[model samples]
Target: MRAMAYRGPYKVRVEDRDMPCIEHPNDAIVKVSLAAICGSDLHLYHGMMPDTRVGHTFGHEFVGSVHEVGPSVQNLKPGDRVMVPFNVYCGSCYFCARGLYSNCHNVNANATAVGGIYGYSHTCGGYDGGQGEYVRVPFADVGPALIPEWMHEEDAVLLTDAVATGYFGAQLADIAEGDTVVVFGAGPIGLFAAQSSWLMGAGRVIVVDHLEYRLEKARTLAHAEVYNFAEYDDIVVELKKATDYLGADVAIDAVGAEADGNLLQHVTSAKFKLQGGSPVALNWAIDAVRKGGTISIMGAYGPMFSAVKFGDALNKGLTLRMNQCPVKRQWPRLFEHVRNGYLTPREIVTHRVPLEHIAEGYHLFSSKLDGCIKTLVLPHAG
Candidate 1:
């Protein structure tokens, strides 16, 4: 098997590796048919995530066919086409029973925070991801579902992470009817969040980003107002002005560690690694949202401390909600939305690269070149 190998920061290559076999009674070996290079994967590529070991493949959003299943895997058989959620968890645990699949206690040894995530760093349970030709899926019966016959494979693959997480971000916002929602970041997740806000009855949706292409996507795909944070002297103040000086009713931060606005924050967190992640987006959320409003955080951040505006959030009585998305939990409604033509997740996909050219794929996405929005990695293609 050929897998994406991480040699160091800003370095990765396709290398031949041993194929994964079922290691647990409940495990399944999935022959990856479609996989995506998520924005979150860039954290590992840039050495932002802790314990991202060399030779560990980095990918989480993937859909594939079951190559083999272990003795206890009864729900799926060989050749079953399935979409696996990013979460690796046991369904019967307390958290899982409560629909907090991302925090399942029975999967990761370090489940004090997030549960096991495919292809994330060791802090996320050290499981190999599906960027390779094959991947080992633990608790296969619980985490994967059969891809709907009506769904495109591209949509199914994005559902494994970006699409699901974006919808979850909107859900976490608790947007009321007629609420004005502002989303920070115009990445796939942010675009989805902005689009989902409209479905949730938001009167207006605003997407903030520094990129012109992504903002253009927000205007066209999401049908939301767009703001380039780089153009504004103070984006927070501008957001307040847009909301008639009261601030937006809800704000979602979809930019995590690599947010670039404050020079010092980005320098310290992203460059020097002094903090867990830059809290610029979150702080902007706190400042841009109205008092007593809700703020949803869907961005991936390190476990370390960040210089966030906790005091302002408390003072303004803001509801702060954040967690690693429980991907499977958002699927039912999402499936309905996709079926009704309300969402076209594949529309966000800008590039598709063969398995052999995945290093170039990573470079394209990481560098934000070629108007890249979302990139899909084809593990089995020429």
Candidate 2:
């Protein structure tokens, strides 16, 4: 099998590797048909996440056919086409029973925080991801869902992470009808969050980003007002003005770890590793939302302490809700939305690369070249 292996920061390559076999009674081996390079994967590529070991394959959003399954995997069989959520969990765990699958206690050594995530760093769980030709899925019955006959393969793959997490973020916001929501970052997650906000009855949606291309997507795809923070002297103040000086009813932080507005924060977190992740976007969220409003976070961050505005949030009586999204929990409604033609997840896809050219794909995405919004990996492409 050929897998994308990490050699060091800013380095990865396609290398021949041994194929994974079922290691647990509930495990299944999937022959990956479609995989995506999530924006969060850049954290590992840039050495932002801790314990991202060399030779680790970094990918979490993927969909495929079951190549093999253990005896205990009763819900699926070999040849079943499935979409596996990013979470790896035991369905009967305390957290899983409560629909908090991302925090399942039985799957990860770091269960005190996040549960097992495919291809994320060791801090989440050391499981290999689906960036290769195949991947082993644990607790297969709980996490893998058969792709609906009406769904496109591209939509099924995005549901594994980006679409699900974005909708979850908006759900956490508890948006009231006619509320104004402002989303920070215009990546796929942010774009989806902005779009989802409208479905949740938000009267207005605004997307903030420094990139013109992404802001353009926000305007067209999400139907949200757009802002380029780079053009503002103070983006929070600009957001306040847009909201008639009271601030938005809700604010969301979708940019994590590598947020660029504050140079010192970005240096301390991303370059120097002094903080868990840059809190510029989060702080902006706190400042941009009105008093007693909500702030929902979907961005990926490390486990260490970050320099955030906790005191201000408390003073303003803001509801701060954040967690690694319970991906499967958001699927039912998301599936309905996709089926009804309310969303076409594949529209956000800008680049598709063969598994062998993934290193170049990573470079193109990281460098923000070619107007790249989302990049899909074809593991079995000719």
Candidate 3:
């Protein structure tokens, strides 16, 4: 099997590797058909996440056919086309029973925080992801869903992470009808979050980013107002001015570790590794929203200290909600939305690369070249 292996920071390559076999009774080996390079994967590519070992494959969003399954995997059989959520979990745990699949206690040894995530890092349970020709899925019954007959393969793959997480971020906002919502990044998640806010009855949606291309996507695809943070002297003040000086009713942080507005914060966290992740987006969200409004954080961050505005959040009585999204929990409504033509997840896809060219794919996405909003990996492509 050929898998994308992480060699070191800013380095990866396609290398021949041993195929994964079923190691647990609930496991299934999937022959990956479609996979995506998520924006969060850049964290590992840039050495932001801790314990991302060399030779580990990095991908979490994928859809594939079951090549083999263990005896205990009763819901699926060989050749079943399925979309696997990014979470790896046991369905009967306390957290899972409560629909908090991302925090399942039985899966990760380090379950004090996040549960098992495919191909994230050692801190995320050290599982191999689906960027290769094949991947082993644990607790197969709980995580892998058969792709709906009406859904496109591209849509199914994106639903595994980006779409689901974005919808979950909007749900956390608890947006009231006619409320103004401002999203702090125009990446896939932020675009989806901005789009979902409209579905949740937000009167206005605004997407903020430093890139013109992504802001253009936010405007056209999400049907939301867009702003380039780089053009503003103080983006938070600009956001407040846009909201008539009271601030937005809700603000979301979709930019995590590598946020660029504050050079010192970016240097301290992303460059020097002194903190977990740069909290510039979150701080901006806190300052841009009304005092009693909500702030939803869907961005990926490491499990360490971050210089954030916790005191200000408390003083303003802001509701701060954040977690690694429970992906499966958001699927039912999302499926309905997709079926009704309310969302075209595949529209965000800008690049598709063969498995052999995935190193180039990583480079394209990481460098934000070629107007790349999203990139998909074809593991079995000819």
lDDT score of model 2? 0.90
TM-score to native of every candidate shown: 0.96, 0.96, 0.96
| Model 1 CA lDDT for position 238 | 92
Where does candidate 1 have its weakest 10-residue lDDT segment? 268-277
Clashing residue pairs found in predicted model 1 = none
- As a TM-score, model 3 comes out at 0.96
Better of 1 and 2 by lDDT: 2
Candidate 1 or 3, higher lDDT?
A: 3
- Runs of candidate 3 exceeding 4 Å displacement: 259-264, 267-277
Any idea how many clashes model 3 has? 0
Error of 1 at 53 (Å): 0.6
C-alpha RMSD between model 1 and the true structure: 2.6
lDDT of each: 0.89, 0.90, 0.90
